[model samples]
Target: MADMSALTEAEAANRLMRLAKLIAHHNARYHAEDAPEISDAEYDALVRENSALEAAFPHLVRADSPNRQVGASVETSPLAKVAHEKRMMSLDNAFDDAEVEEFVARVRRYLALPADAPVAMTAEDKIDGLSLSIRYENRVLKQAATRGDGQVGEDVTANVRHIADIPQSLRDDAPDLFEVRGEVYMAKADFVALNARLMVAGQALAESKNEAFDPETVRQFANPRNAAAGSLRQKDAAVTASRPLRFLAHGWGAHSALPADTQMGVMQAIGRWGFPLSEHLRRFENAAELLAHYRGIEALRADMPYDIDGVVYKVDRLDWQERLGFVAKAPRWAIAHKFPAERAQTDLVAIDIQVGRTGKLTPVGRLTPVTVGGVVVSNVTLHNADEIARLGVRPGDRVVVQRAGDVIPQVVENLTREEPRNAFVFPDHCPACGSEAVREEGEVDVRCTGGLICPAQRFERLRHFVSRGALDIEGLGEKTIQEFLDLGWIDEPADIFRLSQHRDELVGRKGWQEKSVDGLLESIRAKTSPDAARLLFGLGIRHVGAVTARDLLKRHTTLPALRALAEDIIALRAATEPLPDEPPHRFQARIDKAIADHIGVENVGAAVGHALADFFHEPHNVQAWEDLLNEVSPPDYKVDVRESAVSGQTIVFTGKLETMSRDEAKAQAEALGAKAAGSVSAKTDLIVAGPGAGSKLKKAAELGIRVIDEAEWAEIVRGG
Candidate 1:
């Protein structure tokens, strides 16, 4: 990891902004959507980075900082809303036994109890599932709600009533007015069976409709936790009724009466009252016994019927819990001991190079089928060639594959130390298109130069073209593209423009209606000539990102002019005589000279030039180009700058913008013809400093650059 101290104020500010957005996005995907994209450890690393930066630059903290936020976006469900009487707070986690000991000691210290005093705690399996608060009045289950942003939740009372474990009417021993806080989860066996059943049903229905089945669309839960959440939140009670979901009472919500004093006693009381309780729940007198129970559960995690991410330990006595109440988002009295990721040894059968939409090659480890964390693992990501090299793993060797939070398997270590029969050789040619796979300068991953020629890149490339960041054809998403591609109605990017040609054909498809079909075609027609920058970005060029594409388009105006210039520069460089003793550095210098001398496009470099040249020169990609252009004629790029105070000047923005995103701010500056530099330097004509602006403000003062607030920035843009 790089040092945060070494980061400039501008860099830190930008990083803080990016971290805020990334963490928020992952939070949404993990909490509200029941679909997490990254592992828990990976997510933790991001949080740690954000924390480190914030600690070093406290003045730069934004209003949307993840440190202050609890859950992701509040999930707005189709079901009725239910406000939690007592907030369903999450537990602060302890990864190791030392942290567990500290938690116990913290409790003891807070209560001023002696270290030798028996601070009892109940250790129970941490069931990974959606949190539910079931409120009962007069021993009758009144409502059940999901933990939506802690304060309010989606009411699933009708749906939860169908679950056998969650009794509609509690037993006589149940408290008069109390809520049963528990996890609504799917058993491991049930999750597998549900997926299998859905897959079989999907295939039969697809066959009946004379179409292919997509098992993913039918049941795409990555784990039992996701499955449980998805199943429990169904709007239709009948849908929830069909699935197997079970609940285990753990604690309480707002209560009028108590059946027992200790935490274990309350849980036992709930269990006797017909609500299911975790069978692993046990009371321990000290930290060692609690951790011992945690370790025992960790060993049994893989073999359990359902997934258990860790063990939870709460101070057993109710009085102790009251004294050591809640902290920020979690209970200070309760701490969860998270188990490390599950791992299993599997034989590596082969290394497969899979090409992505952008033509980047990824190595996948084909492993002999093994089960870890109750899920079957047949393949793992080697990550890259570097990973393969680092692991020294080869085909026919045994490797340890780990499954953490993600369903995707990863190679952790190679167990077999013996040499391979034959050394594993990474192919230099793309298997998808037989193109020269080149590892570009300063890039770790190797990529196929085939571009649109590669079969692997075709569909994905088009999908990227119409994506929100690109042409943004509103109704045409990935699924629609897939449907079009499958029916041979659309193959190339140009085919999207001609979708109206097959409007009748599209409308006939089961899910495609006349209104939707027409709407989709209208969106395609509206994007016949997308903004030059977006079009260039959608091309999936090797090194051309959206920002670079904008920079290039701002300079070249049109795709043809840019292509002509790029090719001419490459040809001009080819003709230029190389230095007598040409090394790699000299070669780079020669190309740099060609770009600087022959082509004076402001920010064009060797890598961008090479990518553009290679893209235009490829025959199949050229064919794709002609086909696309023949359908939709593109206009020249034009930035009509209205005379403004900020126009045609170099501007630097620091800290949080009050009204717009950083990207939008940069785009606005560019539209009015200002160079939005990332740093504050002597060349800067203007600096827009927002609240929490730190080092950049000082730098602007030192350089004597005019600094203005975000309001002033708006005024300048408004031609005030």
Candidate 2:
């Protein structure tokens, strides 16, 4: 063995600093916000790297190195203080399919149990909420506290008291003191409804400038776990009570109420004592049966009402559990064998078009409701008409639904064997407003010709207008805005900001109690900082995507500048109507070239300019802008984004990449400063041609696009 006795203090300090930053970044993604930058495998690699470094240079590890810690360090006031009898240690997590399987094998090996050993597991929704310890004394619920620092927690007895599901007084036949710890999460339905209610009443909403930003008002939880944590620590008990927060017991930190012979029995006894234990948890006798149970859990995850991060596998015998004990933070006897986050495979029954509040017709796939990871995902998004056609999907076909990372659910494949049920015909009329749908040339999506009169477009437009991305309206949703629209509460977008005149009408609605309506109206009254991008996107201009919206905002920086650009485009078009003698194809090419050149200066293209011209040329479009400007002011933003990394860069990725999957790599490049062209082109920056790269490779050579393998791509990201 190496001596390892000559480590210096200075060297150790540097190591500790790096570990702290890495762990902090991971925690920020994993706890504060739901979106994580790294995949589970990448995260595990970092964790292992940190762990190895700590072990090698033990003196360098900080007290707060993630390898040695669990839970957040943030502290809040106004909660009751309760010390944990046993530390509420966090579990060791597994990210993907292989890690989960590995965990099962390791557990069996360590237990000295038979190859076909009898074991059991509990799979429950890993609620994206707060964690709390509710203590009971002599069967009477005494106090509840937030999971502050594992050692101490703030008292939340009053707010806990408000949760009807949590028994205030346990059954008489109980032990002296008991503690139950679990997550408190807001239901999706409840959250949606609450947002809707807020919108109906007309309220202001908060916006996050950073994707990593976690706000208090928005249940913008990092995941089910963080959501639960935030819900438990509200300063006001009434605010906690008002939230649709509920608790489900996963396990106990300390308990004297049930016999410790078996954890299953303990769970049953806990449930008998009025704790809300899930009915879906199961026990298995052998590894085969355990694996089967996991599959069953995976299958049932979507149907279940709550969100589950993964499945928990544990040894059945309490004595065995005692023998196994724990290693570091995680219990040796129990491992959470989580299923890959909520996924579902269903028949892509049909593709249906939905006219948005902006009159943009979006094609949505209707599927058999199958649970993928945990959520009952019945409808996978088809994005736009272009995607549906590209996928070659039609009605009555089986499709695989997948939710990769935090990205929305999408149809991955056409798994159906049956073919040729009539082709999906794009609708000509807006289903919501009955406005004739028009697909402009050289564009992907079809838009409603109806403009504002279409109810769907009107409603969606209003919502988008008040949306954080647009106008940042605090309290407007489909329901409330629809109600306002139906009741003549507001017609034009400006009317929302000027709703004081209809104060009497607003308060008279069925759900609009005086206090709620007043609160909502007050929230709506506080909107002054509208930005140029927000206003532009709010207008629902077709082909002017989110990126383009931001670009326009940055370039113009003010409403006046944008108005001038619009006027220039309008005048330019008026002076140059299509030449009658000009060949249609030649004229189209010339128009495309001119538009491309203009937008190219700002890194935009022909499509965006044409879209802007179309909107500005219309009189109604000008009126909408004027109406918006009257009520809101545009924010100043400096346009200084470098040409995106993928901009004009053609990259074709093939085979499996250790860092990211094909689609993921594509998405990352697109998100970063680059352009991910489908095929290799002369403009290609680098062809990330992986193993099994076929035609793309041949094409790349022909086009003189530089081809590189996966290793090269990895090197670029690592700054090698």
* Best-fitting candidate, scored by TM-score: 1
lDDT of 2 by residue, 1-720 (tens): 112344333323333444455566566555434434443434554566666566776534544467655554433244456777887776676655576566666666655556666555544444445677888888788888766556676788888888877998877666788887776666656655555554433323332332332333443333333344455567777867876778778777677646557878877877887878766667765556656666777787655665665666667778766555554456766765545533466788777787765566888777787754433455656767776776778877877766533323677577654575666778888888787888765445687888777877777778877865566665677788888898776777877877877778767678877787777777766665565676677777754544567766655677677667666665655665577798755566566556555543343444455567777777887787777678776568666546543454556676545544454566456445465666666667688866678887788778777877777676665451
Clashing pairs in 1: 557-637
**Over 4 Å off, model 2:** 1-17, 28-45, 48-63, 76-81, 95-125, 202-229, 341-720
What TM-score do all the candidates reach, one by one? 0.57, 0.43
lDDT of 1 by residue, 1-720 (tens): 349877654446556655675687677788887767556655665776887887897756654566656665454456788888998887766778898899898787667678889899998999888888999999998988988878888899999988988888888767789899989999988988888887888889899999977765675466788888888888789989999999888888999999999998898888888888888999999999998898888878878887778899999899877656554467768988888877889899989999988888989888899877666667776766877888888899988877666455677788885764666777899999999998865455788877666778877898888876678888877787877787887777878888787877777688889888888878778887778888888777765666567767777788888779767866866777767788755666566556644545443445566667777777777787778778776688777657766676999989877665565577568657787999988889998888888999998889889988888888877773
* Model 1: worst 10 consecutive residues (lDDT sum): 596-605
Give candidate 1's error at residue 427 in angstroms.
7.0
Model 1 clash tally?
1
Per-prediction RMSD in angstroms? 11.6, 18.3
Model 1 segments more than 4 A misplaced = 1-89, 105-120, 137-139, 148-155, 170-178, 186-236, 242-244, 253-273, 283-286, 296-306, 315-331, 353-361, 404-406, 421-474, 482-514, 521-720
lDDT of 1: 0.78
